[model samples]
Target: MTEVDIATKAPESDAQQDSSTNEPTDASQQMGEHEHCVTDRPTPAGQGSTGEIIKLNGVDVYISKPTDYPHTPSRLLLLLTGGTGIKSTNNQIQADIYASEGFLVLMPDLFGGEKAPGGKDTYFADNSTSLLEQVKLKAVEIAKSFMIDMWLARITEAKIMPILHKVIEAAHEEYADAIKYGEGIYAVGYCVGGRYVLLLAKGSHEAGNDEESGMVKAGPYIKAGALAHAASVTPDDFKNLQAPLSLVCVENDALFTDEVRKVGEDIMTQDNLEHEVQVYPGVPHGFAVTGQYQESAIMDAQVTAYEQMLAWVKDH
Candidate 1:
């Protein structure tokens, strides 16, 4: 599509004010317009360690930096939190793990401080010897906890994407030593966050492809992207996917079913987009972030997914 077409179709600016917090959300604010405020934020007691919370362009971000690295970390990872929101203990722990692996991980609060109902304890699988039964039990719990439509209405692509764009722009400026604009930046998303990652990748490609008259100079918003058990993804998302993409799915996820996944994969293959998909057996949606990690099966699948994502990001 032409630059004009892309510009016209681009999402309108996000809501002028956040509905949940009534805070001004001026996503276009210049990075240098305000100084960043870094505060020692603590996660719930005994949950795990999360990096400090920093404000960038009006967004609250949880950033974890790897320590004791021989050299400065070159990779910048934008982690999108699931519907559990950014403050979930599991989400923070996940960020910490990524940081330990030498990634500068930034997880923004997609929900502007409004609490999400389900959290780390959402997994409802009991000692069901049958994997199918376990998946069903987990699905029921997730459906009960998450009001998907309401949350989707509140955090539409139009509402969240601009905020994310500004967050990234500010991140490039804030972490200039470690991350250069359009270089070495990657994203990983879970559940709702996964869908956002796909949008980010699509946006990066559409904006970058139009070199002469693009909105900004043609460059990637994110170098590559990965997702686990992404919710609300459609086959259309794969039509013109640009960046290298990877997906980790559970075999029995209601959100990301086998048929839907196949359709998307077909589209990506037809477009010849560089991408990979791996579906682990006998787990439900949210297996990566919200799974019952105490279970050996769930823990193994989650670890494998994380490793797959890390390998893909590094390879790309």
Candidate 2:
């Protein structure tokens, strides 16, 4: 088997979010991935408790625990919202995959925690439009309510980007203070979340080492990222990413099927960015999750990615 271990210090990846230029708070990244996780305890040796909705400065965030976890400090993952949105994210099939492997998956509700059962969503090209429109509209309300500049205030945030950054910091803080669930972390983002991960990536500059060539000597921090079906990010949009990063795409998706994907690949490669790009065969846009008509190769590809990710974490 061709084992593609994407970096040194073990794991790595990189990301970005949104077309409109808006500034949000910074999100921190941590290191560590595990084969098992612990439950029924305060932060055990390498295990931390997950599964709770956190309120950081008034932002309500939700984290889902991985199933059948073996118990380790902590592992983190993300699912960015795209159009038509991923209504509810506690799906056993999806949640257990990482939890069983020892991860605390954060399915943040960028959109007020509205839960959806599931189904088909092909005709809506405005996939993220649902949430994006929300932020746009909310900006107005926030400005009116708080008496501030609409666009400027919106960029400063109370929305998705800020919430995401806060979540990262909150994860770091929780593990730091918690008696359990305190291992390292890595993030996985899809669509909007994928884009949001990049924002976290950009944040590396402020936190130091945005490319995340390896783990910071300080300790277990979110060390890498895996962005699936990501959106575009200009160099200036986000901070420097310190974590190693990956961007995955389904072969049939028009958004990144050709030149666009290559451009993203080129930027990372030229920068000697710690990252990888995998385009699974015969899969459409949201192949990793539901969205019907998914290919087995795509599913296997995800498994391979996580395995490689675990390996990278160990090395780090």
Candidate number with greatest lDDT: 1
User: Please, what are the lDDT tens digits per residue for candidate 1 over residues 1-316?
Assistant: 2333322221111112123323222222110011000011123346676588889878899988888532754578899987666666668788888888778888998777865443221222223225675455445544533444455557677566766876777877787655662266799998778888887776334454333322353444677999987877788766656778999987755566688899989988887889999988854456566323334675688778999998898787
How many residue pairs clash in all the candidates, one count each? 0, 54
Estimate the TM-score for candidate 1: 0.72
Best candidate, TM-score-wise? Answer: 1
Worst ten-residue run, lDDT, model 1? 30-39
TM-score of each: 0.72, 0.55
- Candidate 2, which segments miss by more than 4 Å at Cα? 1-57, 66-72, 83-93, 113-158, 177-184, 203-221, 232-239, 290-316
Error of 1 at 209 (Å): 16
How does candidate 2 score on lDDT? 0.44
Cα error of candidate 1 at position 282, Å: 0.6
Report the lDDT tens digits of candidate 2 across residue range 214-291.
223333235566666654334443234556777666564443346666666676676676776777664434444422
